[model samples]
Target: MVKPTYSPRRRTGARANAPSSQRTLHLGGESNPGRIQPSTKAAPIDTMPITSDPALEPLHRATLRVIGKSPGTGLVLPQCHIASCAHVVGRGTPPGTELRVQPWGRQPVEVRLIAIDDNADLALLGPPVDAPCPVELQQLMPLPLDGQIQRGDRFAAIGFPKNTNTQTIQCEEIQAEYEFYTHRQNQPSLLKLKLGQFRPGFSGGGLLNLRTGRICGLVKETRDEYQNLGGRAIPIEDLIAFCRHAGLPLSHAEPPPAVASEQAQALAAFLQQLPKWQDLASRRLFVQWALLNHPHAGDYQPMGQNPAADAQALALATLGPGATDAGLDAARQLLQRVLEEPVGKATKAEAKRLLKLLDA
Candidate 1:
C-alpha cells in the first residue's frame, strides 16, 4: 500500500481508562464524583440540548452526497458536490484524482477523500473549505459476542442520502435481517430502521451506538422501505494492526511519524510465543482478552458437534479461572499439543474460538 503522508499528533502516554480532557465543572460549591456540570459555553440551559438530539449535533447535520453520472458508453463517475463532502475530501487526494462536483450553473468544486473502504462501499469525503467545528470520527466500541442482535435495539444511521447538500436523518431499531451474504461477497448487514425516512445518497454514513455514541458500522445502502444496510466498522484493534503493518501513524489529524521495524519484530515475536505456553488458565485469559479488545468481522462460532468441542472444552477447563499460575502454564503446553494434532481433538467451535483468540 502507498504510505499515507499525513502526520499525526503524538499521543501523551495516558492510561486507556483515564478521564478525557473535556471534563465538565460543576457549580453550587459541591459536586458528586460521578456527576459533573456541563460547561457554561457548551449550550444555554433554555436552548435545545444538541448533545441529546443526534439531529442537532453538527456532525449529524453534515452529510456527503456522492453524485455520479454514467457516460453513455462507459462506467459511472462519482462526484462529491455536497458541502460536507467537500469538507471531508479537502487536499487529501493527488491533483488529478481530487473529487470535483459540478453544481448546477457553476464550475465544479473540489473535495478530498478522507477515507475509503472499497469493500464496504463507504468513502468519507471532505469539503475543500474549512469549518469552525469539523466533524470528528466516532470512536469504536464493543458489541455483544455471545448473542444475536435482536429487533428493537435502537440504532442511528448517519449519511448524506440522495446526493444532497445536507444529511437526511433516521433513528430506528433492527426490524430483521433484511438480507445476508457470504463474507467473500462483501457481507452487508441489512437492518430495518424504526423511522420510515431513509433514502438514496445516504451511503457511506455511520451507524452509531445509541448509548455511547461510538461508531458501530458504516451505512452502505437504504431501501425505500426504510431498511438500512451497513458494513461493520473496522475494529479499533484491527485498525491499530493495519497502521502498524503499514507504518502509518495511528493519529491521522496530524503529520506522519517514523515507525521502527523493531516494533513489528516485537509483535511477531509475541504472536509466535502465544501458542507455545502450556498453562490453560493463562491461555484462556489471553484469548478472552483478545476477543474483548478486538473488533471481529462476525461471531466466533465453531462448526458442528464433534471432537472439536470436546477438545476445546477440555482445554478450557484445564485452563479455566482460578487454576494455579503453574497449572495454567501446563494447560497452555497441552493446548499447543492438541492444536498440533490434525484431527481427533476438540470440537470445531472450540478450535475456531481458540485460533481466533490467538489471532486477536
Candidate 2:
C-alpha cells in the first residue's frame, strides 16, 4: 500500500481531537486530511440523533485511550480482551510489545498485544492475570450479516483521542452512505462509508449500528477525509471471522429473515419508473419513498429478466466515474432522453457534463 502525506495546518476552533501528522490511510490515491473542506450541512442533525440512546452509553466505557507519543484508540470486548487497529499499535511491532491503556473511568493498565490480523488491520489485547477487571463490552445484537447497508444509514463511533481532554471522550454520530464494493482489490471488499469530520482517535474503535446499538464492525481507516469518501470498516462478517480466529466468544442477536426475491423485484420495478416521473425531485423522492417504505428490500441487483440493467446504466451514466470510453458513450446514450427533454437545469447540466466527460 502507498503511504499518504499529512500536512499540518493551524489549529481550528475547539481542539476536540488532534490530527496525526504521521499516520495516514493509504487508499490508492493521495488522501490529505487538510484538503477536506468543512461541511456546512449537518446531515446527522437533519436525519436522526443517536446521542440520546442510553443503550450506546456503555460504549463509552468500552472505549480505551492509548497513552503514548502518538496515542490512538481501542475498544474493550468480552473475556478481558481489547480490540484495536494493528496499525494503531504498530502492525509489525513484534508480538508482546508493552502498551498502556486507560480504560474509561479507570487508572491506566498495562496490556500486551496477543494477536494481529494484518489483512484486516485488527489487533486483540489482553491484560495480565493480576490486572484489574477490564471494561465490559456491550453484547448488543449485530445487524444481520446478509442484510444490506443502504445509502443513508446512520451510525456512531466512540474513541479516545490524545488531543481531547483526558477526562471526556466524544461520541460522534453521523449519517453514512454505502459508496461501492471493491472485490478485486488487495483489501477485502468493504462497505465504504461517507461521514462528517472524525478525529484520529476514532480509529481502532467499533462502528456501531444506530438502530440496533450493536458493534457492526471495527473502524478500519478513513479515506479522502470529508468529501464523502469517509472511512472504511471491517464489515461485520470480517469482524466475526477475526473474533473467531482469536478464540473470542461473541453472542449475536438473531438476524432478520432473508429479503424475499419478490419484494426485491417489485422495488426494482418501482425504481425503474423513477426516470418517467417528469422531474428530478419527484424521481428522487419517489425512490427515497420506496426505500423508506421497504427498508429491508435491498438495492436491485442487475439481472437478465429485469430492468435493473437500464436503471444501473442510467445511474452510472449520470453519477459514476466515466473511466472508460465505452462506459462514457453508454452513459451519454442513456442520458440523451433527459438532455433532450426538459427535466430541469440541474439534471440537464449533469447530463451535459457526463457527455462532456465521454468526449474528453
Candidate 3:
C-alpha cells in the first residue's frame, strides 16, 4: 500500500469541473448538446498539446470523446481496440452495430461491435477495415491497470459529463473499496467512489489511480449532485478479466507492460521534453532506447515532443516498459505496411528492428 507521492503538480485548487470551467451536459443524450469536446489546451488545433500529469500524459488520444449509448467517453487502446461500458454503448448492444467515435479534434470514424458482455456491462469494438485506427495518434501507451484498489486512494477519470459546455475530467477518492450492488442488478461488481461534478458522460471511462499511475477501475456510475455525491465503477479486475477472456491485447500478460510506476514518471518526463509527434523514425527509436533506460536516451535530437501519436513509437513503448504485449501486433502491422512503401534506410531499418523485437 505504498502510495508513491512524486506528484510535482498536485492539482491543489480549481477543480476541472468548477463552476468557472464547467459546461452544460444535458442528461437527454449526445444531441442533448453535441458530441463531447476535447480541451483546447489539452488537444490544440494549431499547436500540439503537452501535459505535466505523468499519469494522464499520452492519454489524450487514448481517451476519446464518444457518443455511444449516450454522449459517453471511450478508451482507444492498442491492437485497434476500443473499450467502453456496455451501458454507454447500449447494454445488450448486438455485435456488428456501427458506432461513431471522434477523437479530441479528429474526424468521426466508424467502429464495429466485436464483443459485448451484459453481466459485466462491458463491450469491445474494432476499427473499420479501411481504417487502421479510430484515432490518428496511435502510439497510445495507456497506463497499466493496478490489480486492486484500497480505500481512500485518489483516482481520476476523464469523460463528457452532462450539462457541461465543454468536456471535463474529474478526480476523487475511493470512498470504500467494498462492492456496491445497484437496484437494477443482483451482483456487486461496482465499487463506491466520492463523486464530484461527474455527470452522464462519465460512464465507461477508465478510473486511473493517481498514485501508482495505473488504472484501477472502469467507471460505470456517477452522481453530479454535490449533496448525495457518490459514484460506482467496475473494478479494474473485472475489466482486465474481461479483456483476457475476450482474447484482447489490453491486459496481455496482466503484469505491468504499460509502464512501471518509476518508468511512468520517466516516460512522462521524456514526453514533456519533446514537441508533439515529430520525426517518426527518431521518435520510434528513442522510445525503445528510453524504455530500456539507456544513459544517452535523452541525447536524441529534437527531444521536446510527445510520441504518443506514432504507432511504431507506441509499439516500442509497449515492447520495453512493463513489457506488455498489447500494442506489439498493432505496431508491427503498421510498420509492415510502411515497409511496402518507399522510405529512407534509417526509417526502414528501424521499422524492421522494431518489428523483429515485437516478433521476439
Candidate 4:
C-alpha cells in the first residue's frame, strides 16, 4: 500500500505513480495535516486459528469470516459497524464485488464497504446499502481505551483460520503474547506477535488480550523472524485513530483507576501530558524544552543542584530515603522510544503537531 499523504493538496510528481486510497479528501477551507487517508492495497489473507470456550463464545460469535474473492475475518462492533484490515476490503477491489460475512455458527449475509484508512491499515464496513444487517450479532468486542500492552501478556486471537484442499487448522486454544512494536520501512504500523505457530486465514481477526479479555489489536499477517516464525498485528492505537478520523463509533473503556495511576507513574509527568505516549514530535518538544528551558536543564537534582520540579527530592522529603530508580528508569525508556524513531519534523505539518500537543 502507498503511504498516505496527510497534505490537503493532491500530491503530484513522483507521488502520482502511487495508487490513491483517499476516496474522500478535504481540500478546501481549513487544512488538517494529521488527516488520515485511504489505501488501495491488499495483503495476503489468513485466519486466526483459535479455539472457543464458554467464556469466549461471545468473541467467537461476534467475529466474522468475510467472504470476498478471497476470505478474511472481521470483528463486529457496536452500531452495526465491522472493523477489519483494509487489505481485506482493499480500495482496489471490484466495485461490483459482492462481499458477505459469516459470524461463528451464523449464516453468511451481504455487507458493504463504508470507509478505509490506508494510512492506518484499517477499514470500516456496514450492512448492504439501503439494507439492514440480519445476522444475530454477539457481544461486541471492547477496546481498552489506554491501548497499553505489557510484554509477555497472555493473548488469545479469535477468528476463522482457513482450510484448503482438505488441510486443517489446529482448533485448540494456544498461548500468544505481546512482545514488541515493529516499524518496518514502507510497511503498515505493526505490533510483533509472540506465538509458536498459526495456520493461514487469520487476517482481520481480533487479537484478544486474555488478561483483560479485551481486543488489543487485529491480526494482520504472519512473519518469519530469523528462523523463528511469528505474527504481526495492528495496534489498538491505530484502530482508535482510524475510528476518530473516519467518524465511526468506537467501543472502548478506560482501565481501572489503579491501573491508570500505575501507568501514569510509569511515565514522567512531561511525557504523560502528551496525547500519544509514543508520539515523537510531542516527546521531542518536551525533551528540547527540558534541556533548554527547564531550570534543571536536563539533569536530575543533585546535592546543591537546582531542585525545580524535582520529584526525587519531594519523594525523599515525604517518604524518606529509598530507591526511586524504577519510576525514573521507566520514564527515561518512554522518552527514548520516541527519540530513537522520530517522525521527521520536515515531513509533518506544524498545525497537526500542535493538535497532538494540545490534545494531551
Best by lDDT: 3
CA lDDT, candidate 4, residue 240 = 62
lDDT of 4: 0.47
What is candidate 4's CA lDDT for residue 329?
39
* Predicted model with the maximum TM-score: 4
Off by over 4 Å in 3: 1-55, 129-131, 134-139, 163-185, 223-228, 252-360
Q: What is the TM-score of each candidate against the true structure?
A: 0.33, 0.52, 0.52, 0.57
Task: Evaluate residue 135 in candidate 3 and report its C-alpha lDDT on the 0 to 100 scale.
Answer: 40
lDDT (Cα) of model 3: 0.51
For residues 1-360, write the lDDT of model 1, one tens digit per residue: 222221121111101111101112121111221122223332222232134444324333322223332100000111221222111232233322445332211222344444433332333343454522122111111221111221123344443222111221122222112122223333332333333333443343444434333333334334443433322222222232233333333321221232323322332233334432234454444344333332221222222233333233333322332223333344344445445545333333454455454334
Cα-based lDDT at residue 211, candidate 2 = 56
Error of 2 at 209 (Å): 1.3
Q: What does each candidate score in C-alpha RMSD?
A: 16.6, 15.5, 18.9, 16.4
Residues 1-360, candidate 3: write the lDDT tens digits.
011111111000101221112323222222442353333333332222334354454444457655676657777655877788887788777787888765554545578777788767787777765767634435444556664332234566667655432233331222222223233344534555653545677677777656566677777876544532646777665666667666674552353333333333433333333432256665655444333332211111122344543432333343434333333443454456556646667666765765565465
Cα shift from native, residue 161, model 4 (Å): 2.8
Error of 2 at 43 (Å): 33
Q: After superposition, how far is residue 200 of candidate 1 from its true place, in Å?
A: 1.3
